[model samples]
Target: MAPVSLKKLVKRYGALEVVHGIDLEVKDREFVALVGPSGCGKSTTLRMIAGLEDVSGGTIEIGDNVVNDLPPRARNISMVFQSYALYPHMTVGENMGFSLKIAGRPPEEIKEKVADAAAILDLTHLLERRPSQLSGGQRQRVAMGRAIVRRPDVFLFDEPLSNLDAKLRTQVRTEIKKLHARMQATMIYVTHDQVEAMTLSDRIVIMRDGHIEQVGTPEEVFNRPLTKFVAGFIGSPPMNMDDVTVADGKLVFASGATLPIPPKFRQSLTSGQKLTFGLRPDDFFPTGHGLNSGDAEAVAELELPVSITEPLGNETLVFVGFNGRDWVSRMLNPRPLPSGQSIKMSFDLSQAHLFDLTTGKSLVA
Candidate 1:
């Protein structure tokens, strides 16, 4: 079934280790993304999976077989790199079939496989065009077609869409999703973009400083982040956070603002405990502009002066001065409000998050 397993994988350059013996499992035909910021060792882990990097310790298995000693070609995995890696002089069809030709496959077999892959990737019409003649999106499709022709058990993509513009990146991302569905091949994609990871992957592995921070489905990580770093990283505008201390069953901010602790976390907290209070823009909004309809008991109302506003057609992002800082709040079906105007804001404490100041871990439990 080609389920890939990595047990205590490690990578080191001399004595300095870059991958800190992380463990992960990819189910057969599932799409998993390894994502993090730059220098997070995500690309390095993907390289090890493709047999392009040597494993310093532990075992890597594809299905039931150990492939640590196997060469790239023998691992039965296809990798599409960040660069298209196409030959300047060769046509798209030639580039797609080059691997098969080098393997001494019959001319008819190579042609058939390449033609099939080209049709699947909508590159049949551009088969004769060289890489230089195609647009960025078309060139990326050709790169994917090359990998498809191999019919490998696993597919590896290393930031394949990062080179494209925003529009082209979205277009290519959709195509890659369709490709995975059609092939039903185990895929491991690595990228630094959180949006790409959230939209493309069935599960995401977030890494930091050579260590895995968390691994879960997009919804699991976003709605219930286990750590403060994850809560800050997974959301679009990011979760708004401020340091506070527990006092008299209330969260006291540095600016002397106080908020009642939500009922769910009241019992777990104690007076004088340091915490980082978090609330998403969606949960903190202008009184009538919020998305939540349920009557939450911990809701707080305050009139805050607006600092600025960003109108995004369907919704406006309002920056209001709260606790001595400009806290962003999402306003749906927005009405134009000039800067310095005071408006009633709602803080949904039921949707709030509390993290230990020292450990950075969620205090929900």
Candidate 2:
């Protein structure tokens, strides 16, 4: 953040090249999330930005200054790590004031800064407690306090809530988002969780195989993914993907099921052209005299024997298999679904996605 720019960035270890050339311009005060699967270079990229790792190629500029050789502290950035990186022996006050003390700030100034950050993060009450006495959320807050007291031009978060329980993670996610709004400071967060990326990011750089798959707002990446990988990776429950072929001007799945192609899509595909069909489970629903009913062509019914039924308080997720592939359907209303019952399911092709089989690129632009 603070307008970080990576011009043709690359990372290499001897003969192994992990990150190819990547050019990105991160605007000042923007909260951008770099998200991808493991080994996809998201962490490596963040480390490089933090000056924790060396860039094998290209230039990294932080606020108009090229910081290619600067150390982490010299880069004027504070990072909240996944491990919390808090000293167990230090009290919260000491932990939060450590950075200021290291910078040779006067004791009174350090004390005032720690107090201010503690108040901001609601950690003032726990200022005298050791990390050993704190809960996971409290410890994480102390780490954030440690980072915020520096008042760095930019902040880096490397999955800081990964260690927390589900409820805590959710709470911290909201807190982090609100804190960003409050601070109005530049930030770059890295995570593999799609929900984390979608909820927290102002803009996301979707990464794959050391390359950027797509970079856009969450809605853009979810509603109109540029690549097959982005479409599959960025959705909860994931988008359903299956081999498909154009037959008789219809979208034909490999299992012999057929769905009607949208008018624009039907005109684009060549008959017999091999493709892949993708759709989020939430995009499909029982046909009613409503929004997507008439638009869905060739409603192929599936007599699916339910394999698993997960009924939460507000919704039900039914797991069913079809032709060696698992299909999940999310029902908003809570309904008891008995296993082995033949459930009728349909595909809504109007909102479906078509990918080129060879290139894994979206066919319907």
Candidate 3:
């Protein structure tokens, strides 16, 4: 019953407003991630929920209580930051149990809580080690262990893995996922990394310029983005975008390339309307090499020139010249594609996206 409700949340720094009238509900035991580029107010929103920042307007409720005016400790939540915030001189056990110790909890109770959290995070062996002696991942786990021992109603993580190396980030991400499953606690994570938001959250809140752009499950945001900004921001290497216009019942690119109007939008789009066409890198494949080979009704073929190829072990990313831009394509079967080579590529229009140029809203529906 530890659901969190944010009602028309707003934040302002004197004369400047940052987070505007954003509302969200985080279900009990659900993991929701707040994600957006810098200055989008994701962090400010999270801080408001944690009672770390004062809400300029709106109400924040935890479970059944209005926590807007409550202090961070009174909100009954724990936060993990990018800085780990561990005491360098204190041993892991001491650091993890320090909050309880400060609250006048008995030594025996603190020990039990610390031991339990340590075991859950696989840090029992490192309890005696100081932060200075631990690896980056270990320090983060200790930081998480500190939060777990509090047994708070909600957990807030602010880009907790941004400092880790690539390999370590992947490993810790898996560990955090496991931790979430084991605890089943309601959590709200703030991060700029869409990949982290996709992998860790049950739902994602995408924000921009003090406003929320979209809120949906990772699949919904990735496969059916509501706006052009979200379609381009949520994917790795992102979705390709090109300016286009409706002419003669066809989608004509500014570079003079043309694609037949997708049947789904033919009735809604008027002639002379401008749009931003979008296609994911994975949806564009070399001929006979697409993931959906059996589905060819919406497939369009184009002989495009390659600009560069990046080999990533099991797959290669082919950068092809399209509409006078370098469009990336993910090739499943690994192969060396020479630059300046012309290759037949397939565009899966079945998965294509179109946004109104004037509004940036999806053209569909």
Candidate 4:
């Protein structure tokens, strides 16, 4: 069945604990990505799952068997590293089949498995090439090919695409997605790039400071972040946040900009309560230029001076002065607004977020 579960997993380096008591589950054939900034213990957690590190606390189960004490090889898992870890002297075919060869598989069987994996990864034509002779993307494919030949119960990838250039990363990302669909094997991927996690994973496990911040599908995490950190970290360009106070039934920012409290939050807030207001660039757009211009009743108007504008082909990222800092907004069907120019922007408060200042948690139920 290959369902994996971590029960209160903990990792400590001597007296300094890194991974706290975190629990997670990976259903068979489901792809999950652990993502966070550096030193979040994501890689450490993955290593623990691979049996490369000792667990300081908690139990890990693959299917129904507890695998805490098993060596990596005995755990029946394969890992693809960012380094591409292929032997420089060996051909791609030989590299892909090395693990089976080490297990004393017959040459014919190794060849067949390697050939199958190569065809699946489209590395058939490059099988004879050495790692140094292949492009970065090809080497990564060969690395994936090596893991595929193992046919393990779980696949662990640690920032496998970070070594590739931007364009190649996208290309290989698509390949990995296809590979998962083709094999339907349980996979756990770790990366710092939220975009990678959002685009590639069935569900994302966002970690921070050795703790899991949130675990949900991409939409859930992006649209309904449970914590202020998750809301800030999940989106592209991030969510625009400002310190705000409840005053006279309105949200008053430090810069004197006042907005009506979102109707859903009005009953929950009281005057003088400190809060943080969050708005994604997607929901803050210029009037007459947003995705839902027809929903005009939901829009709140604001006049702000443009700080800068970044044109991103189909949509433009507009930066304007708000609450003493540049707040970014995404404008569809955009027109250029020069720096320092005052423009009327539309804010879709229906999607706005409110965080309790003291708890750093979302105000939504």
List the global CA lDDT of all models: 0.91, 0.85, 0.92, 0.93
Ranking by lDDT: 4, 3, 1, 2
Q: What is the TM-score of each predicted model, taking all chains together?
A: 0.97, 0.94, 0.98, 0.98
Task: Estimate, for each residue in 1-365, the C-alpha lDDT of model 3 and write its tens digit.
Answer: 29999999989999999988988999999999999999999999988998889999989999999999899988889999899999998999999999899889999999999999999889999999999999999999999999999888999998999999999999999988998998889999999999999999999999999998999999999999999999999999899999899999989998999988775677888899999999999899898766863557788899999999999989998999999899999999767888999999999888889998989999763
Could you give candidate 4's per-residue lDDT for residues 207-271 as a string of tens digits? 99999999999999999998999999999999999989999999999878899998678788999
Model 2, residue 43: displacement in angstroms? 0.6
lDDT of 2 by residue, 134-251 (tens): 9999999999999899988899999898999999999999989988998889999999998999999899999988899889999999988988999999888888888888888777
Which portions of model 4 show Cα errors greater than 4 Å?
A: 293-295
Query: Who wins the lDDT comparison?
Result: 4
Model 2 residue-pair collision total: 0
Q: Lowest-lDDT window of 10 residues in candidate 3? A: 288-297
lDDT, residue 95, candidate 2: 97
